[model samples]
Target: MRSRHVSVWIDAPPDVVYAFAADPHELSRWAAGLAEGSLRPSADGWVADSPMGQVTVQFSPPNTFGVLDHVVRLPSGEEVDNPMRVVAAAPGAAQSEVVFTVRQRPGISDEDFDADIAAVTADLQTLRGILEGQ
Candidate 1:
């Protein structure tokens, strides 16, 4: 198993940042490389399907803070679950921090985890731009 965590500071309150980040419509704003995605009601949480594959929202704290779990199905019928979490900085500050954590499944190699982290980091930069009014 492998994991990566990255965080960035945003010049906004926690709630404002959290709300924007949680919106499905806003996902495309940050996830630029994504092919497509749409909202789907699921017992898991808020789910969506994108070019990267199927992602399921796991725990969403009220006020838009939470974690989302994703799984991609390979052509060979194999599946890997990637755990992702978003943690916000305390409220009332001029800037807030958005943290992303990713952990790949057991059989997955470090190379795969590193690649995913790179992709996710790119999106995070996009996300920061959108929130910071760039």
Candidate 2:
């Protein structure tokens, strides 16, 4: 599988950024590519409407390592793993870098892969704007 990492630098501490990004409730504010205002708590995770239809999103447990990995189950019963992270740009730095990794499945075309990358980039930009109060 091919993967692309889309990132944004937020002018906030890693912990702050991680707290916001790791919360499924905050996804409506910045994760336009994944969920809008349609996210709600489900029995196992969160359910949201995506371009592809309804999806179930399950995130990794909160931890100090800043890992925000998640699995999104599509309407077609396929699950996609989304790897994300929030880390200090530099040691002891106040700023944080948020990275989202998008992976291309075996049958995806180049154009589709590019569009996926673009969507992730836009989502990260939105996250930065919200976090930095831009």
Q: Compare the candidates by TM-score and give the number of the best one.
A: 2
> How many clashes in each candidate?
0, 0
Best by lDDT: 2
**Local lDDT at 98 for model 1:** 72
Worst lDDT window (10 residues) for model 1? 57-66
Q: Candidate 1: where is the Cα deviation over 4 Å?
A: 32-35, 42-47, 54-91
- Note the Cα lDDT for every prediction shown: 0.63, 0.90
- Residues 3-113 of candidate 2: C-alpha lDDT, one tens digit per residue: 988888899999999999988888978888888675888996899987788899999999999999999998988889999999898888999989889999888999999
Question: What lDDT score is found at residue 33 in candidate 2?
Answer: 81
- Which runs of model 2 end up more than 4 angstroms from their true locations? none
Against the true structure, candidate 2 has what lDDT?
Answer: 0.90
- My TM-score estimates for the predictions, one after another, are 0.69, 0.95
